[model samples]
Target: MRDLVRQGWTITAEETAALSPYIRAHITRFGAYATDVPGIEPEAFDPALDEIDFTVLDLAA
Candidate 1:
């Protein structure tokens, strides 16, 4: 997840900062992808499905 965030995977700066803590909490409890993350809905991850109301984040260079 950290690598994905660093590689610019449609996440915000604030969201990027929060990933580590979220990952830590999740790891301590259940571990990686244990629960649904807030803001990023489940459907947003589906490559085959198109979403009409999604904002595309500019990937960092």
Candidate 2:
């Protein structure tokens, strides 16, 4: 659309710089395609605690 506008109007660097990449109006008209996945969430990892052995070790003195 910028290119289309650029054909008629002379957009300067300042005007172009003001443009947003977060412009969502163009795609919002298409509506949303939603998906839900249950019981697929990953558990958080704790390397130090998870890797430790809870069992006691008896050592010779």
Please name the candidate that would achieve the greatest TM-score relative to the true structure. 2
Q: Write the per-residue lDDT of candidate 1 for residues 1-61, one digit (tens) a residue.
A: 6788788887677876775544444344744564555776554555654655345454432
Query: Per-candidate TM vs. native?
Result: 0.19, 0.33
Clashes of each: 0, 0
lDDT of 2 by residue, 1-61 (tens): 5776768877678987988888566577666755676657778876778666666545422
In candidate 1, where is summed lDDT lowest over 10 consecutive residues? Answer: 52-61
So what's the TM-score on candidate 2? 0.33
Off by over 4 Å in 1: 1-9, 21-61
Q: Which residue pairs does candidate 1 place in steric collision?
A: none
Compare the candidates by lDDT and give the number of the best one.
Answer: 2
Q: How well does candidate 1 match the true structure, expressed as C-alpha RMSD?
A: 18.5
